[model samples]
Target: MAPKRMPKVYLVRHGETEWTINGRHTGTTDLPLTANGEAIMLKLGDKAAGPGKLIDPTLIGTVMVSPRLRAKRTFELIFSHSPVKPPMTIDERVREWTYGDYEGFYKHEAVAARKAKGLPSGEGGWDIWVDGCEGGESAQEMTDRADEVVRTVRDAHRKWYEDPERKEGDKGGDVLIVSHGHFSRCFLARWLALPLPAGQLFVLDPGGVCVGQYYHDLGKTALGAMNLGLI
Candidate 1:
């Protein structure tokens, strides 16, 4: 019962945008959700928020949202049912991995472009997690950013977990994040103390939800759920 009061982190991926639909690397470009994106987000709001849902509005202590319009819009949709707005941080740290020169290009296109430019596309070909975008962030940079996200989330959770009033019926709130697909995966990998490439091990769809909770105590974190579709 004491463990149940331990706060969890709710990871949410933004809904689809035009680039998302076309299989393009949408990084740094602020795009709004599509009509279908909005519809799906609305459906997700119904299933994800409120009582007995994966994200209980009243139980959200902090929200870390990407500065991108798509991610910000996703938060609005998810918590549309909330009685009061939760505290949020429009953190650039959770923003998508900027594609740089590969921006707006598909994975294959980026690979082909890299090959044409006489760049090392890796033996297996252009792996963003390994080689990274030509002019954008490197794997190490993303790792550091992901580390920051983990720390901030842990701090938010600590408040509820260590509260003196928690021994009673005080159920602490959870930390929420509304970010892009790749970034969220990376963040989760860092949360689990795994390498950045381990992010490729899991896939998170647009409007999907992932949950992480403390195991044993607040010191050890475990994946509660991943790639869960609300809509």
Candidate 2:
């Protein structure tokens, strides 16, 4: 039997949609991936999620996904390549940040609207990390949601490690989260106790993966790899 090892959490961003291709802010809109997007996801599965691939399905303990269609479908495509399906759940917290009034607007359009309203809007103006969406999630709200993700992952790891009966090759330590781009970046920021604005530094591509793990117990979380592209 293979020796037991620390579980690595896999963070996945869903593939492209029309809105994404058009640079629109997508939130609360359950849009399907483009045909090309779906094809690429199937490729991602074959490249990354198998017995000895980068993300071995058998090693994953839990799989959490956004309730949105895009994210859910991404989860399906990736795991479809592997038979060892882990326990999966739908979590609204992993959903994208609500754009509210800015929904469906491109970057330039949103900036223009903010400028017209006399709100900060321009280069380095009206940044989501600072001003947030006028009618949707605030930076603090994103922080709260990210914190919840961190807490959930940490608690799961804690339980897995504390179980006296846990043996080598058991699949209860690694985790997988299929979510949106911005929110997944925010989760990475919060996982390292960084400021929400720092999330901007970690831009995730669509149909990509980020991996993280704990070093000296659940208290110390570490980012192992990120932006491992699939498509």
Candidate 3:
């Protein structure tokens, strides 16, 4: 059996907002939480506090969030009852992608624009990932940023792993991450050392959480459990 101890990452995507429901690329816009979103997060908090085979509330060490208002609000409301509050930090590298000209534009709108512009269709052209809306991020640009964030966090947490006395027989240290949708998917791909394009494989929704477990003996590998939606 695997040891009771291991390092785990609990990922929480912020709750739904009007933009999310509309299929708009929300990137960097600061949208407030919907009432439905708030309720889902409250339930998620209750779930976190309950006992589980692989998760324990007390073992969580840090709560990191994107600086955006949506993520911060979700974290604040969800952990309101925790007596042993961990240190919280905002990381820009983990923030939502800057959508640039694409901000707030709907999917069909962009598709129509692509057809009108007669942009190239493959490898380096107008597909949703590679093509920016005139002046936004190509999927590749976002991937690079996600990779940098994952490495930086992993490196900084080496101390958690280095300490021999820190619960050698439990789920060990954990981090609670609250972030946006698109970049969160990208983060998952990078964490698993998958090709950046592999991010396209994951579909994230509002009020959903994904868990990633890292097995040290197995090397820096990421085991992802995805799309645990609060709804």
- Candidate 3 residues lying further than 4 Å off, grouped into runs, are 1-4, 49-57, 115-118, 121-126, 165-172, 215-220, 229-231
Can you give the TM-score per candidate against the true fold? 0.92, 0.93, 0.84
Best by TM-score: 2
Q: What are the per-model numbers of colliding residue pairs? A: 0, 0, 1
Write down the lDDT of every candidate, Cα atoms only: 0.85, 0.85, 0.71
Cα lDDT for residue 48, candidate 1: 67
- Candidate 1 residue-wise lDDT, 164-213, digit = tens: 66544454468888999889889989999999999998889988999988
lDDT string for model 2 (125-183, tens) is 56988888989999999999999988998787777767778665675577899999889
Worst 10 residues of 2 by lDDT: 1-10
* All candidates: CA RMSD (Å): 2.0, 2.0, 3.3
Q: Give the CA lDDT, 0 to 100, for residue 164 in model 3.
A: 60
Q: What residue runs in model 2 are displaced by over 4 Å at the alpha carbon?
A: 1-4, 229-231
Pairs in steric clash, model 1: none
Of candidate 3, the 10-residue stretch with the lowest lDDT total is: 48-57
Q: By descending TM-score, how would the candidates be arranged?
A: 2, 1, 3
RMSD of 2: 2.0
